[model samples]
Target: MERLKKLMVGLILLCLFISCSQKNNKSDGKLKVVTTTTMLTDLVKTIGGDKVVVTGLMGEGIDPHLYRASAGDVDKLSKADVIIYGGLHLEGKMAEIFEKLPELGKQVLNVGESLDKSKIHFIQENTPDPHVWFNTDLWETEAKAVTKKLSEMDVKNSGYYNQNYEKYKKELERLGEYITNRIKEIPKNSRVLVTAHDAFGYYGEKFGLEVKAIQGVSTDSETGTKNILELANFIVQRNIKAIFVESSVPKKSIEALQEAVKSKGSEVKIGGELYSDSLGDKEHNTDTYIKMVKANTDVIVDALK
Candidate 1:
């Protein structure tokens, strides 16, 4: 019933946003942009350049799957000239908030909405995986979408956005190649990625690894003791040397699996922390999206090798 109420409220908000009587009259100096994740915030800042001011709701080590907007966050959204987010329920709890923004005349855009529906991988019948940024090529698509949207918003700086997009595209192409070649260093059978949650489905599909997670697509999904014991059994049977913990997810999940492995007289190590829903801290190399992928790849390859 509560979920039904939320959906109904979202529907009403969508109607208001699409055909609402109110809207911002014109550009008031620089466009004030608010984003849901650090990746979107970074991309907009990179492409929007000097044309906009960006605010990101979630930071490094924060889980978007578990994040809820505070009253202050609501105030920030209310004042935003443009709102952006990684859609496809990446900001799952904030669906109604996004629905209401469009009605308020804010330019709200979801990064995932730009992708062709057929191309996105569906984990469970019709449930599209929202972690598109894991695959660099797909992430490039999001980057291009940001470029086009920024161009439309700040026509004067369209050229700048295009230039930045071109440069970033080349860099992404290189990053994709880097991940591909680096992955080759590991033998095929060892190319399995086990993490706390199934966030790496897109990464595995694109980069050629079999992914396993105790939790479902969302971190909020219920994980049972049976599932954990079964996954631990699979790891021991397959002789997978290491499983990983996610930066955003609780380590206890993976730790439980490790304990299960030990109960069967087998040993498995926690590979290393992988960035699932969040980026690494500023002092580390994974402060940026591209760098984060590289960091994860290195950890994965090193552990598996």
Candidate 2:
């Protein structure tokens, strides 16, 4: 571990040296921000507006749980005036890189860590579920955190950031209500969500749906055979008509589970895709955070209703 740490330090410092020369060249004299997940990137862009130049590390269908910072990502981070990311092990693979970033005198923010820690769900003793964005209320909280970060980074645009945060947070609150009403459309007894991984614990708790997943909180963890058997039994026993596949995770696990149900003389539909760890592509309806939530809710309501 010590050797690995040294190697990472070496890599970060080297990138810092290379990026230091590019600091003066902003796209339009904006605060350059680097974010981890597509959701965070969108949130920051919304909050920062025209005052900030935001670059996202993870793109559409990119899994933050298993994402490692490439050489180019490090260079981006080094050039950034502020670095922000989704916390709570969502970017578990890049934890070391995030940790080392602060030492380079760059303002680094873990957007999710600003919330009341008690509200966070722990899948294990130290492992908290990192999909806090699924809960729109929590997303609102993180938006304010982003507002605070942007204000600090570019004090001149503090008012602009505040205005945007207020506007966006309201949208998130409405989104929470929208999801609630949509979930209600599903008969109460059928209010169960099964997905590729355990990314929706908070979503289930908030929306009053019982969520079951094949894998644990982090996608880095593997799905166990016993888990597959138990989850297959669950869908069969509950008469669940649909299970979901995440955009970022491979469909095979859920497909395998679907086959398991078939073996037990039942059929579970794929329903449709849900944007779990990341957002959808630019042309898709789920290209943004709000749109992504609505799209997922639409899929859930239509199939389960």
Instruction: Tell me each candidate's TM-score.
Output: 0.91, 0.95
List residue ranges in candidate 2 displaced over 4 A: 1-9, 21-27
In model 2, what lDDT does residue 5 have?
Answer: 59
Q: Which residue pairs does candidate 1 place in steric collision?
A: 17-102, 17-103
Worst-scoring 10-residue span by lDDT in model 2? 18-27
Q: Which numbered prediction scores highest in lDDT against the true structure?
A: 2
Pairs of residues at least 3 apart in sequence or in different chains that clash in candidate 2: none
Worst 10 residues of 1 by lDDT: 17-26
Task: Quote the lDDT for 169 in model 1.
Answer: 92
Provide the clashing-pair count of each candidate structure: 2, 0
lDDT of 2 by residue, 1-305 (tens): 97985787677766776676564566578899999999998998899888888899989999888887788887788778888988888888678767776666768999878989999998679988888888888888999888988888788889999999988978888889999999999999899899999988888888988999999888888888788889999999999989999989999999999999999999999999999999997688788999998998899888888
RMSD of each: 3.1, 1.8
Best by TM-score: 2
